[model samples]
Target: MNANFAERLAELPQYLSAHVVLSMCALLAGIVLSIPLGIQAARRPRLAAATLNAASVIQTIPGLALLALMVPLLGGRIGFLPAFIALMLYSVLPILRNTIVGLQGIEPQIREAARGIGLTDRQRLWQIELPLALPVIVAGLRTATVWVVGAATLATPVGATSLGNYIFAGLQTRNWLSVLFGCVFAAGLAIVLDQAIRLLEIATRDRRRGLAIGVGVFLAVLVAASIAPRFVPPGQAGTVAAGESPGAVQNIAGQTVTIGSKAFTEQYILGALMQRRLEEAGARVVRRDNLGSTIAFDALRSGEIDVYIDYTGTIWATVMNRSEPAGRYRMFTEMSAWLWVEHGILTLGRLGFENAYGFAVSREFSEAQGVDSLDDLSAIAGDLTVGGDPEVFARSEWTATRDVYGLGAARTRSMDNTFLYAAAHDGQVDVITAYTTDGRIAAFDLTVLDDPRGVLPPYDAVILVSPQAAQRPGLAAALGPLVGAIDDDAMREANRRVDLDGDTPAGAAAWLDERIAEQ
Candidate 1:
């Protein structure tokens, strides 16, 4: 609809291609494996019932829950592989069930006729049952394919770039155009695939069967060409060339570094930027991102990740299991010392950003109730509903603070961070757990309550690196200057550009780089 719309639209091809590749891989794998299983189960009634029931149970589990369960087991892994596997698991039930049903639906007389004509059981299945069952099997495939294509879009939350990127970015920034564009593109691609397969189903009927096989081969070749680049040999991922130094750093200790982050806009941008910088300095780089706070912290401790950016307040309250009744500087200083002694984690200095946790209420609600401080809100808390991110419920800052401040909400619901602001602004919820630095708080004209109990923790963004990573040449030197370059005001404005003005993350990162470089 505007220049920004066109710019975002230009990103569609790469996004759509990734989406299609992942969806197809899962679809193919699911079909190839499920068909045989389906056939076997069809011949054996008990096995068929058990297999179909198990698959149906898997189908009943929430997709996001399945993905979350997979991340820890898969080792904070990302890209297309984990998503592909999960989507394939989901695709299995429909294909397998339908194949079994289709095969059984074939007439018994046909089997008898084939047997009487001297055909073996195998020949009967191949020439008679399979041919007749093709259309129903194709229908099952079509259903699975559509489901997979839509689910693959969710892979972006784990750092794989697909159409979900557009949806996430749009939601965070309140840009409906980008969201609409992503939905339209995904739907269009699914329709095209469905039509192509429908054509194959029609052509495979009787005399035109040879043409359908040729068409499938041509499509297979096209898919292979597109996906070949991503399938590099295993060891190639972390290999470094001899004598080629990056930045001022030379050789690292025969190890590739993986820096990880939680799944959020700010976190993703910071993680990607940090990875790029480390790579530029000549060290091999990998990323383990979209990890929860506790998981990422544990990953660093276990050496699954070399480094990650965490908040000083999160460490003080969540990791160190201690709270501070002090200001930002004091909180960070105490948290930094405690981390080294208690967790053996080196807090590499603050990133000059302070993202504090606070409670927010709609402007109208606040004005109507004259609520301004934790004490004032406590009086009216019983009438107000609370909306919070999933982490907020368990995090000491929210739960402990509510108790300490004598605040009580009538009801509380966990929702995505973006939805919290929208729900509050729209008056669906009277209160929300909000970040002090979030751009949406200001954009929505919501007022934050004063924490008189000093219950909330100070959240200063800090880089936490493993003790081994600290020894790398030029690592600290390269990153030290960025400390204190991104204070509250600068961060608020950058976030505003994206959240209120619909600027893309790349555009926001560029602006941040300029600001940091200028200092």
Candidate 2:
């Protein structure tokens, strides 16, 4: 196993940079906004009640839902902005509640003594109340910091590149190393930040010098804000010269173009193969693989990625979030229309492979029950249990088809894709949602049922690029030949090489490079 733990740790700097910066920004914003609200609420009971109530309401929402809600309201394309706002909203309740409690807990006699000394209201707050509240406020900040760090992991679902990228990518590929990597880094960040805050709290214990803690935190934040854009690396920054956008020329002699892929093995392999081809053609190529589908699309649009392969069926069903009956032509037409209207996204062309949906059952279950097509399976559904990934139940094709085709099982349970596959193979589940091109189908010798009712959509593997990106000179030409190069067998073999053979994606990519070069 070429799984270099040190190499993975070295890569940590790139992934953690975004997550740490966003988390700190949310915490700082929460502190600035909550302090005044907390102070006012402390002084005025009714105001305090209302402010805390609002913050509490925000806290009640699931972090994922809150992040999702921000998309429609703030333009879904603004990736980090929505996550930052949602995280900030989450930070407020703990800070506000603690702040109010801390200030209100101050003895009435202390307030009276400050006023008796001829101190003005502002003086009373700065000289007395704030100093007294410091310890408690720090406690609240500690609570909020932990919450924000954990919840920020959910940001990857909304297309912001973060450490959670490893978790999602690992889950799909069943590479536990990547998942563990994400968990460790995210947890480490929280501990580090909390300790830093504790050190500041200790250093600024004196009433007169307490504000130094706030000043130090503020300066640290300013430094981070100054460095974030450079961390993300601006378009055409550092390497590419001015006016030299990625994919701008029909060919490039020295500049590097990054290509990204979704988490699945096929996508990862294809992405690496594309980079290899580009590099062979004389351009320096960098690979960013195992990104989520939505995220990969976003990066392409942002010019963070130049190109990668995608399925036409995915463009129709997942990206456009649309439903149409199964047929390659119908799906292609509908998706092309939607992409043009909504995102100016264009499907360059289709790969030769048709990687459509198909349900799988253990060989024993299929043989025992005489189940084959969905219609036959629906007959015995009341006696069988079905397992699938959580998202399948909510997706239109799955939902609409389940109802339209009258496909049912005695019970439906949602698990992650890998788990679903395992359950069906072990006979713990009689049936599962599966993809035809998935290598596990062969690994477990599972039987795929015919969709006689045609409930499932045609998921022909296709490549999609942003209209703006496609129009750039040479991108289409560079990518045009790879279309229709792969078949279902080739895809399944590639996936098996990773899933069953325990090969790294880079190794799988190299294998694919050899195959494509031969073709």
Candidate 3:
């Protein structure tokens, strides 16, 4: 095996252990807290209905949103605690509802027999009621165990290292093998945990003494191993947030740096390229990839990560909330000054390309309609439908485009980024919000309409560094060489290697780094 691949194989134990810790802790906490509440609710039908309704509402919120909400609720932290809480909330309903069902299903005759036998309420619960309800309660455990385990995969976005780490990274880098590994491992784990719970449920039957003790001991040890680490100091818990690698050692040139990337293919390649360049400059680098759209800014300000590549337009529109468009240099000037003043972040010069948003249509459609610009599209706006990632509809640029071009009643379709290209290619939408540098524009032979109004500001990819990282020796000088190095065609081809040719992000980065170094 290649040395690097072997190194990755060695890290699996670390990732697997961290994943198990998060999932098991969440599952155990869910079972322990939900059962008693379920019992109390069974005695009060009105309360049961209201409580279950609330839990159902919680389950409705997307898992990603729930995890993001916890970041602020927990005071700008992301990782184990927030992930654990979110998973616990998700597991509540099944366990809670089943607990209520199991408790209330007990016959009145059974309760009366216990009462006449001189048994108190608490004694009856432990001896008679619980003994009979054990199977049903175990069924709830079976359900909750599976739900929490599967949902735990979403924890990757929150900075928790679950099996999802592989999936999220793979998807961003276009590495299908990594994605398959994550999914298969997570699914296999879910099946095993469900089967174990089923065994415990079976043990609730009489004449299953051997199976009962064996399965009971297995669970006890499994849960015990998870619980024991909670009492240890966090650093010793064998799990870590970003940048907590063991030995805490040196990077290139005996210096260390952390690079961040938003959740996209281009960002992944840029982040990897930066890390590679930093390594060549003799600094050791760590990576925190797959951050949310705006999360990268906050993470940099708080020193959770050191550097990331962000677009000038994104900062102008999203961070500054500016609706006005300006020339490239002017927008960069304002953006750099604002970011420096507010967050102490440094915009390390542009990387020589503008990946701005453009409205695109098929070459044939553009030619047949003679639609060369936004104004031309606007003239026929009613006859066309627009589609893009949901962000395109909510962003200031979209609002400006809509108002300036008078697309008020034009049909709009919002979908996932993965589907946008195919949708436009198949003529599902007449126009699309295409990133100017996307390789698919060429592959699909689409014509990018001109923007006479310049509603969207320039989107020059620039490196951003935290205030502290800026002070490091030679950091700025080391990265200065990358400025104005990659152009539109270069970026498109780099992206094509990953998005079209199925190359991994790291592989694409390595190739680019070599080509740039040779230049």
Candidate 4:
């Protein structure tokens, strides 16, 4: 087996446990909240319309969007809480709808018969209505189980640990094994839970007390086993470092640090590098990878995350909402001052590299069109189609570039960041927004057009620390050495290791660390 696969397997218990716990909690919460409301709605016509309509509206709002919206709604709280809330809300509609339908479908004669027998309305509901509705209600629960389990994979970007970690990291690093591993486990979980619920439904419908008890016991055991690993004492679990005592390194012992990273290969590599450095200092590090650019910044400002890397241009264009050209150093200086004054965040200085967005084209296309710069491309812009990642189309950088270079006349296509290079190479797109540090530029033999108008801002990568984390002893001391450590070539090489050489982010980070030490 591959060493990387082995390492990922070691993390399975943690990931699987979190996934199961989260999905079960969300589904349970949905059942608890929805069944009661569903019962009440069944009794009143107006309430049923209002409640079902509300749930349907929420259902219509895409699952990922609802999850992302929860971050800001909760004042930048990420991880289990936001993810749980969103998934729970998502689970509500199906169960609630089913409950109301099941109860309403019961015959009037049945209710009349119970009323004639001296049973109150409440007694009639529990004894007659609920029993008849068991199968349909169980079906809803089964549907919700699958939905929540699958949707839970998207919780990774919100800083939650789940099987999504495997998928997100795999997509960024192009590791199909990791992606498949996450999918298979998530689907298998859904299947198991679905089957268990089916058994309960059968027992309930058939009035088989023994079978119901057995199914209940099975679920109890499953839940216990899934969450057991979480209760294991620290250090009793396997050491992060093989063959070394947990207390061997104590530079920043007893301190806890959280690192955040955006959803991409470069960010993943940088995150792993930071994680390794903090671990070497003996800090217990927690990583929140696969975050959106804005989500990461918000997390840092709110002190939910201790440290992460951000670019000068991103802060200027998005956070500061500034459009005027400030020289690279001036932008960095002003951005640092603004962050400190407004949000109490500290800028620990640049990492000696820049990964700017550049318009790139295949060598053959560039030579054929005699295009060497944006100025040259603008003349024939209307005849070509440009491609970029989803976020780029909405960014100020794209707006500025479009207006300045007359690219507004060109067609646009949004694709995954990793696919942009291949699209350009295959002639699917005439031009693509390429990251300067991406190794694929060289591999694909593409030409990055010169920005004669200088519309795009400089993107110097810098380290940022939350105000709370900055106050910690030795935090800066431990991380300061990395400020001027990696140059552009080194970063590109690190990215190349992951993108082209099939190295995991951790392995690439280790290779980069060795290179920096030699330097």
Q: Against the true structure, whose TM-score is highest? A: 4
Task: Give stretches of model 3 more than 4 Å off.
Answer: 1-18, 165-179, 204-256, 279-286, 467-480
Deviation of model 2 at 6, angstroms: 4.4
Clashing pairs in 1: none
What does each candidate score in C-alpha RMSD? Answer: 4.8, 4.5, 5.4, 3.0
- Model 3: per-residue lDDT, tens digit, 1-519? 964355446545555666677888888888888888988998999989998999899989988788777766766565678889999898888899888888899999999999999999899988888888888888888888888878888887666777787777776555666777778878887887899878777776665889989988886776566555432122211122122232322222567777888767888888878876666555667666677756677668777678899998888988888877688999999899998999898888999998888889888788888988888876787888999876778888888888898887678899856567767878898889988888778878888988887777889999899988877765676677788888877888888888778776778788876767676
> Per-residue lDDT tens digits of candidate 2, residues 1-519?
466465466556656887887788899999999999899889899999899888989999999889867755664343578789999999999899989999999999999999999999999998899888889999999999999989998887665657877777677778788789999989998888887777677766753365666758765874575456534432232233223344534355455666767656677677766665555444666555555556666666655566767666566677777676657787778777776677777777887888766788988888888887777766776777778876666677677657865664357889877677778989888889887888998789799988777767777777777655666655566666677777778778888888878676667777765666678
Stretches off by above 4 angstroms in model 2 are: 206-263, 275-309, 317-326, 341-343
Regions more than 4 Å wrong, model 4: 230-251
- Which pairs of residues collide in candidate 2? 310-462, 311-462, 312-462, 351-484, 352-484
Sort every candidate by lDDT, greatest first.
Answer: 4, 3, 1, 2
Model 2 quality (TM-score): 0.86
Q: What would the TM-score be for candidate 4 when compared with the true structure?
A: 0.95
lDDT of 1 by residue, 56-141 (tens): 99899877666556666777555566778888988998899889999999889888889999999899888889889888888998
Error of 1 at 416 (Å): 3.2
